[model samples]
Target: MKPTGGSVGGFLAAVTPARRQRDAETLTALLQDVSGREPVLWGTIVGFGSCHYRYPTGTEGDMPLLAFAPRKTASTIYLESTAEYADDLARLGPHTTGVGCLYIKDLEQVDLEVLRDILTRSLAWSEAGGSEQAELTVTG
Candidate 1:
């Protein structure tokens, strides 16, 4: 739930499948640029910026404003609910979505610009205290 202060390069370099490594690197640069914050490793996730919130049940913790993890099958980018950006995701190419997750099968297969816009908008939403931030997981 905290910065851990781990080496971003160490984690990215260790990612399997060269393609995922490239994608992770690309995402790191984009998120850092969009958030104007250095990337930090929260276990397997590379995250930018930071925020703290408490749920109604009082389970409070901090999480990255934006984050992504290079998975064995796809790149998992964590963000606010896709319901808020249904239009954008439609243009993002072949991908899947979870409660607060965007899964890209191949970074190269998706539109980088669209992905960038999503990251930018997601960061803004988090900074503005997005409605569901309190439910945002700190586990990644």
Candidate 2:
């Protein structure tokens, strides 16, 4: 995905389901704090930093190094190499995963500290050029 130069405030303000909106705000702040990067809108996703990923099939694109979206069902947290986070995920509280996506239905149900650690590690991984890693695993 590409950054749309969209206003993060406008996007968050337009979020439906007041609860989701509130959670999005909290997440936005948390991500920004942890990432130390300004939030950018990649389509509907609020993302921080950027990484260029080339899949095995050579389908490549640029995406946020850390990002999330507030959806009707849950908040989707994007991270790289989720397979490497098994232990961390176990301590993350109620959540589900799909490849690189971490789905959190309720942020309050999880330990914010653990979430912060996970995001921190994930950011470090991306900064260390994880997208160019020889092997990319996302078995979650």
Candidate 3:
């Protein structure tokens, strides 16, 4: 499905409980700072910037440079799943991964600095056409 270009404020308000809304807001700000792009509400997810992806099957679509969803269970961070980010993930504190997403129980459970590094590297990777594999360093 195509992105809807919805309002971020509306989306945040729809999220249940004040904590989730606050979390989403915090994530939005961080992603914006890291990506240097405005936030776009793609359905329920807050996405920053834009990128194009083509699967091996030739299926291609446009996605955000960085995106996340404040779900009931955790905050789902959308990022490219590449080996280059292995080190950053190792220092990200408590989190889970799926295909191309990083799931954190909450902001407190993970290292914000590490998360910022991950977001920065992810944005750089996406902006650089995401063709070459490059390693990144994470400092505490």
Question: Across residues 30-135, which tens digit of lDDT does each residue of candidate 1 receive?
Answer: 8888889989988788988778767778787788889999999999999878787899999999999998899987888999999899988998777776664355
Rank all candidate structures by their TM-score, best first, as comma-separated numbers. Answer: 1, 2, 3
What's the residue-level lDDT of 86 in candidate 3? 83
Off by over 4 Å in 1: 132-140
**Model 1 clash number:** 0
Give the TM-score comparing model 1 with the true structure, all chains together: 0.91
Residue pairs in clash, model 3: none
- How many clashing residue pairs appear in each of the predictions shown? 0, 0, 0
Q: Across residues 1-140, which tens digit of lDDT does each residue of candidate 2 receive?
A: 78999999999999878878888999999999998888999899999877776666777677788899999889999887578789999999999999888999888899989999999999877776665543333211
Task: List model 3 lDDT by residue over 25-126, tens digit each.
Answer: 889889989987888877878888776676556666677778999898888998878355789889888888887888877676778999899889888777
If both were scored by TM-score, which would come out higher, candidate 2 or candidate 3? 2
TM-score per prediction, in order, is 0.91, 0.88, 0.85
- Decide which is better by TM-score, 1 or 2: 1
